[model samples]
Target: MFFLGCFATATAAAAAAEVAAPVPGYVLDNTEVREIHAASLKRDYQLYVALPDSYRASERRYPVVFVVDAGYAFPVARGIASRLHRHAGMEEAIVVGLSYAKGDEGVYSRRRDYTPSVPRNGGYRSDMPGRPAAFGEADAYGRFIATEVFPHVAAHYRADMRRKIFVGHSYGSLLGLQVLLTRPNTFEHYILGSPSLWFDRGVMFDREKAYAAAHGDMPASVFFGIGSRETLAPGKQRSRAEEDADMVADLRDFHGALAAHRYRGLATTLKVFADEDHASVFPLVLTHGLRAYLKQK
Candidate 1:
């Protein structure tokens, strides 16, 4: 009877343990978080950083890859970089995920912070529905990156300020383009995936024109990527301007425009993945973009 009682007790204990809530998992190793407040925008932001496994033992400075849309991109980039460095023979660099503004993440922060210009009549567009009514604050956000993020990163990590790489997608890529056009020196290499050139009726073209008009030379390398299925197919039952962006053509036009300038020290590459759409192109973009980053190594 005692043996049966003990067996029953043990079985109950095992079942209880199985039903217990699982412990929280910390997936990314050798990673850290840094907080920096934007004074101009009165917003708090966090930099989700992943360091190379060799970071601790080595005293050498490493170029940093800054990935925007951290909430979605951080873990992906971290895992890809680690895998590439370990098996794919790619060089390792520090990865920084630029997160959205805390407490204002979902609908407002990115629209406001990543756009280069604000539109009239509530600044909402059919192309990018569900966007906040107020946006177009990329200038201030760029300032935050330049003035605050730069200093913060420089002070804390062994980041090589001279060789910063900027990674962005859609609106994030649009912000990267804003910085690239206005100040090409901000990031030496740019991985701009599926940019929303349709934003604000191509206001960025004017910005590009402004850059070309003022500058004799642009010193930067850009990797432009898109997907074959980003455009609206006739039978897809589309709605609104979201499916009408024709992002593939936009990607080519932007690449062609950058190439046509033929500026000194400027180089660009474009890749379109078959059987993928805007939603699924980011990983390939990173894979190829990091391969392109090998030039800097």
Candidate 2:
């Protein structure tokens, strides 16, 4: 009877241990999610990090590609980085995706964080009846990235600060431009896709003008891409006559300005993808952009 009691107790304990075992769920093989409190923005952010396959086995530091709009762009960036490094002979890189906290659709947050200027009379009046608040907080956002994000990544991972790259699209590209113009050293290379230079009635041109006046040279490599079909059309809600908002023309003009300036240490390339629209060109942009930048030493 004593032996039987001991057996029963051991069997019950084993069952409880089995029940407490954790069930594994599928996850990206080399990715981790970090919840960070951004003191500059006074809010929380989710940073998705994808390390190279050899990161754990090797002590070598790797270049980092920081992707903005990570909620939608992270997977694409991570997959492309892996494929390019594995098959295309490009250098392996650590990809970091900057994401927002839960429940944030990113409409207001992105606008406020990515744009460089707000209209004088407050926010722009949207087609909707109620106007959203004014934005133009790129400076603060840049500070957060430079101070908080960079330090955190460096502390926890093997990041090569000298080879940092910034990738962004649309308004995110505008933010990239702001960082490029204001804090050139923050990123050594920039990949800007379909930059919304139309924001604030061609305000970015003024920014370029100011940068040119203040500095004689820009030491960076930039790849600017746009879709061929991004030209003016009735479906696009803007007419060709309105050149300020004409995306294709604006991109070309911006490229022309950069080329004409011929900043001593700047290397710039512009590519127009055929048959692609604003939303459809990102993957192509990223692939080409990564190849172009990664081909450098």
Candidate 3:
């Protein structure tokens, strides 16, 4: 009876101490949350900036990789970069994760910021059911990155402005495409993963047509990766709307288009991962892409 009482008392005291103690929150290494405001858009965004381990030790200006859809991609990219740099012999770059509008839900903000144009002739986005009916201002959003984000990074960090890289997936890829088409110089390298090319009635195709008509070359290194299962199954007949949403065909066609143009100094790579769908293939895209593009020569 006496021993039981003492053990219980000790356990109770330990539990009380634990309850009173400060709880430690999770933290990523060398990462900082920075709040930046877009003057033109009148919106504030959070930047998840993760520095390389060598950043503090060296005076070298590192390349900066700007990743979109930061809420999910930031941490994953950070981890991948670290692993790639440590074991895979890839050059370490400063990873910058671009967040959505500070106060708005991500879906709302991405619809407006990541899309190239509004839908045409009642074209519905079946994926984003109940998404805001009207939104597509990527031109303005691109300005925000060029004007606000780039300058800010250049002014603050030891970032090599000439070697900017962009990594984006799905609708995020739409934004990347717009930037690549309209302002190729904004990013020297682009890793576009499973792009949602069916958005807005294939309006991006029109944009590409206009770009080709004006420019002789698109100077950039581009990589496109998609999953095999993103298309319809064997002999599975889908509706016209569903067939139109075939992402696999979309990426392949766009890649072919880019190649057919024979743009001077435009390097492009396309990879399709087997046994993976849209959601399952994103990590592979990043891992394979960063390795292929950023590998130490």
lDDT by residue (1-297, candidate 1, tens digit) is 999999999999999998896988866789999888889789899999999989999999988888989989988988888888888878788999988889774557788889887854343543345643657888778878988898889898998889898889999998999888878888899999999887877777778877888887889999988999888677664322444667887778778877787888998999999998989999999889988975433
Tens-place lDDT per residue, model 3, 98-180, is: 99888677777888899898776565543345654547889899989999999999888999989988999999999999999
How close is every model to the real structure, measured as TM-score? Answer: 0.87, 0.84, 0.88
Error of 1 at 295 (Å): 5.0
* Colliding residue pairs in candidate 3: none
Error of 2 at 226 (Å): 0.7
> Residue by residue across 1-297, what tens digits does model 2's lDDT show?
999999999999999999999999878889999988988777899899999999999999999999999988988999999998888889999999998545445776787789898844353444324556647998788889999999999999999988999999999999999998888788998999999988877788899999998888998999999999888866556532234267888999998988888887899999999999999999999999999878633
Write down the TM-score for model 3.
Answer: 0.88
Model 2 local distance difference test score: 0.87
What lDDT does candidate 2 reach at residue 10?
A: 100
